[model samples]
Target chain A: MSLDTRPPRQTPVRHVATPRERDEQRGLPTRSLLLALVLACITLMVVDRTSGEDSPVEPVRRVVGEVLGPAEAGVNAVLGPVLGLPEMLRTNDALREEIAAQDDEIAELRREAHQNPYDVARAEDLRALCAMATNTGYLLAPARFSGYSSAQSFSSTISIDAGADAGIRPDMTVVNGDGLVGRVLEVTSHTSTVLLIVDADSTVGGKLGESLESGFVDGRGGLADGDPLDLRLVDNTVLPEQGQQVVTWGSEGTGPYVAGIPIGEVSKVYEDIRAGTYRAVLEPYVDFTSLGDLAVVVPTGEDTRVIEPEACS
Target chain B: MRGNSRLVAALLIVVTALLVQVTVLPHLAWNGVVPDLVLLSVVGAALVTDPRFATLLGFGAGLLLDVAPPADHAAGRWALALLVVGYVVARLAHDYQAAQPGPQPASTPRPPYLLMLVAGAGGAFVGTSLFALTGLLLQDPAVGVGALLEVVLAAVAYDALVAAVAVPLVVWVFRREPAPRVAHVLR
Candidate 1:
């Protein structure tokens, strides 16, 4: 048959498929929709970055917090024992030591109780926090951690169960039985978010208890990596020895971090050759992984100007 | 009705993953990094859903994670990251199925476990890298660059491990129903 004349030898499959076929060939993905969603995400990030406190996303975040806060609390309560298993495993030795020490103290207390019948009252919990509050004359609001910052986040933050209703406010110092846990980042009606001292974004002025060497202590933000806090001394010449205690050097108006709250202990001191600076690594006293009860320093409206600066001895 | 049920199932999985990631995963972290369950959920959804739905699912899951309490990064970082993951994963899976020699039955056969794993790990690496890069560009990186790299590596491995378990479960649930959409593509 002549090329064009044999019943129009059915033209080789043209491959000129219809629009629907083309879509099927590509697996039915609407490229425009994907692009739109991507652009929307970029817009959101830009807005959230530039808007600061007033970002429209804030309300949505708040609403999520409002909805999830109680649910998290419920889940936390249910999972409390399971969650403590790891901490318990880690602190097994320390806890054993504490029990032995407490045994002797308990025996001594029993003898004392035998001598004086009226002295049977138990000591209060969170003695360090209460004592520090008493010593510094700062009013304290007690709270518990409701939830932690999402694992996916880079910042170390915690949601406390107390907030404006409990007189907790942003930038207030939060402490636990061990030492400084973090500072209140923001507050809602009944909950507050604390920015942990171990976050890379957080920097607190700290002083060596013995040498009085002051430095800026910032988190390595690698709590997951078991990284310690880095203390960059203002006086690069003075090298702090290992085991030196670090404490907050106090912030202006006693906000964010108060003076004298123990921060950490110098674990290792090293010099950076490139920067020509000596840096100390600190092991923070607070067991951030197992943070439980915490207290926020609420200003008592007392004459703070009269209160003397007290070292958290 | 089938489509709506599938959407609900995907939403349920993502939300549940988010709650667990934030509430329980921290205590289970190894060396300070926890598995990104929400991102894995997006991968799982992508495997079983159309690319369009997968992309949207990724954005929604990412937004929920971004705005979820304890999420301090820019609101859209995760959203953007997961959006890329969802679209890429679904597109790849779709094309893969489309290239198969015969007409796909109504009951879609599961993609090989190895393919699922590779897809999951790839999605995780892309999503995490994007999230970290955005953090750097925004000048609000949670850790130093060195530490951030470590986190990204740990996150990918952890996510892949969890996805091995979780993605199969998601695929089983979504694929149990005769997927008319997928069957239509093969025809």
Candidate 2:
């Protein structure tokens, strides 16, 4: 068929003002021009603050994060090793003493290794069962620390080099071999931001190691303050002792944090008559200052990080 | 300088400061007091540019940081804080310039280094104090008052140091086109 050649019906023209025209409109009120911008910012702050995890700007933030996250991850990977040298040097003496102790333990373990092949196999099976029982609800994803918040003294968070691509999402509990680190706060395609447990706003449900008394633990956002987290117990009957370990009371699977992850040890305890809670200082197992790698707790039955527990490994 | 050139220069300064702040500055944190390169740049921009433009630029830069990864507070807190800082610094610069006369063509003669340092210190203090206060109102205070005060002092000192190097360079980049002498009006 011959191509239909005809003057196209005139499309209705809409007058969209050009950017230059808009700029030339000097009649625009300053009250709305600049004041409105600041006012809008304030409005957004209130909305975001009040909305918590379900904030409206989350999708926009995720898009921006996806674009920037990989680049940040690349830069951190290149720089982290070099930047960590001084800290390594500072801890050399301590490591040497620990290495000596580890050497003695290794010699004993080696001696035991030769004794019983049957017993060793049985022990391996038992260890696997223990790990299975302990981490039954967890599907963990490993991530590397990419960057930290640039604000001085006003924030404490780290960006990890893993995200939706690795089954990570906002509010997933994070941990290390030692204990609980924090949780995923915001996630992008290839990266996620983690709010450390030492941040002022972070709160978690924690249980005492021995007594099993449970309550809330809050972060103090201490950066260089030796102690930065606190725990509170509201049970008037149970008394908490110093050096007792605190662990998370695993939250809902899709909630902000997962359970059974160690939080810290109680360093100090004070009685609060009015609040009916005992406030205790926490000395965290993982140092917030020198974060390297962390793992996000994904729910079981999902694809997870290929990490074997220490007992099994 | 032409407005276009000035705009490019200002943007370049902000981006470079951001890159360095995130990548290199972390290693330099001394007792948690890392220098605020972005705040220094805003102060420097205000010292040379128009107040309105500086204020808007501050808002934009602050917004970029507020949303960037690792940011924990609400989205607009930094923007509001920096908006005020930029406006104050720009007004101070304008007033300072009004008090002095110079014969330099195309560009105003440099203000006293001490003046730039003072503006930097003031902006740093105000910017950090606002960040903390707004965070407090948001119920997400990253630190307590004792820590905030230490930060404000540390920021002032660090901004002064950064301004010594950054201000003159920014002044050169954003230098205004020369204008014929016009009589001042005193209301």
Candidate 3:
């Protein structure tokens, strides 16, 4: 196409230097900035409160969680074999030793039983007692943990492989075969996060096995001198012994945590001079370091009530 | 050819490092302390790269760490913190004659590279401190001074060790300068 050669047309350019015009332009941006700040503050406040309340943003949280979950699983899978090699070797050795020792003990017990018929009766009674104390009747779902919160001094929470699909629900009590672990705080389709009993925020209402005294066991953050957990004896009447067995007191009206699950053994008991309360240090039944597999106790409505032997007599 | 491949390789390395940190690190933890492998990777990247790419690399690394499990703080917090670290290290690199100019610097003397070390340590300290602060603000009462210091120290020490090897390796992997040519006069 041929270029058109013509006189250039000039449109009149308007310039306004009025103080009022400048003021209006400046005012618009100032107002917009203020509005933005206000909106941001309000949004932050809402988010902050919602997270604290433990409200039902779980679906959204889970969506965000999905991005990380697979990568976490892959990492776990690859490292599983590598990390397990050492432990497998050690465990194999330990198992052999334990099996030999157990065989010797069984032979001795059999010999004693043969010598005295009363020894057989005594052994049967002891086995029954052990079974009752351990509560082997309860069905448990085992889970493998993936992640744990690293917020240095806060409540230590762990994310396990089992979740809602595995019949895990919020507030449901979690335990190892040995004792109480914690309650399920949040659950997704395929994963659940557990707030451990030793976490600062966790509180377990427990009873001393010997005296049947009841008190709350609160987690004091990882000990100052690297001592075990200090369980504050909240109840004045409840005096726990040094080697007392601690068991969970059923949920107060809420069906979250079940009763009679072993929590820990009282490692040490100290009398607070001023408070007149016993501060017992509980060594948790489930070792946090060796937490490879954990079981979640699914509550069956029928309460396995404990009958007092002394009362029956 | 090498430059493009090296960048891609670095990204892959970072992703793998983050994955290891989030899942495997917890299991490998000793006395509740796991090595901060992601921080080490970021420090390595920052040490080897130019100032322009520092922030981008840091943000990418931090984002990966934030998305990992056990992440309590908001997503962008670490990203912002690491960005600052990368910038500081890159700026410090400009003044140093110890490291030869290339995609990766050959073994630099220890003393002159102290600035980079300080930057890495300071970055980890600041990043971890911010994370702790975020926890506190979120009403996590358990976070105290002692715990904060412990994590900060651990992260700094771990990151420094990783940076030492990572910097050299990155430099070598991306070394693609044309070999010096010998000229012969026509007889």
True contacts kept of 3: 0.18
User: How well does candidate 3 match the true structure in TM-score terms?
Assistant: 0.42
Better of 2 and 3 by TM-score: 2
| Recovered native contacts, candidate 2 | 0.44
DockQ category of candidate 2 = incorrect
- Cα lDDT tens digits, model 2, A1-313, are 8998887869866778876555334122244556887897799899988998999867767776776567677787888888878767757778888999999999898878866775665455345333533464455566777888876757788899999988887888877646788888899999998888889998899999888888888988866876788887758657789999998887676568777777889998888788666778889988677665566777655665544444343
Total backbone collisions for each predicted model: 2, 1, 1
Cα lDDT of model 3 by residue, B109-156, tens digit: 332355545655665665566556555665444677787778767766
lDDT of 2 by residue, B109-179 (tens): 56678887788788888898888888878767757788777877887787777777776666655664434
Model 3 / residue A70 / CA error / Å: 2.1
Which stretches of candidate 3 lie above 4 Å from their native place?
Answer: A1-64, A87-99, A105-117, A120-313, B1-7, B97-122, B133-142, B161-187
Chain A alone, TM-score for each of the models?
Answer: 0.55, 0.54, 0.50
Q: DockQ for all models, in order? A: 0.43, 0.21, 0.08
Q: Which parts of model 2 are misplaced by more than 4 Å?
A: A1-32, A77-313, B102-109, B175-187
DockQ score for model 2: 0.21
Model 3's CAPRI class? incorrect
Pick by lDDT: 2 or 3, better one? 2
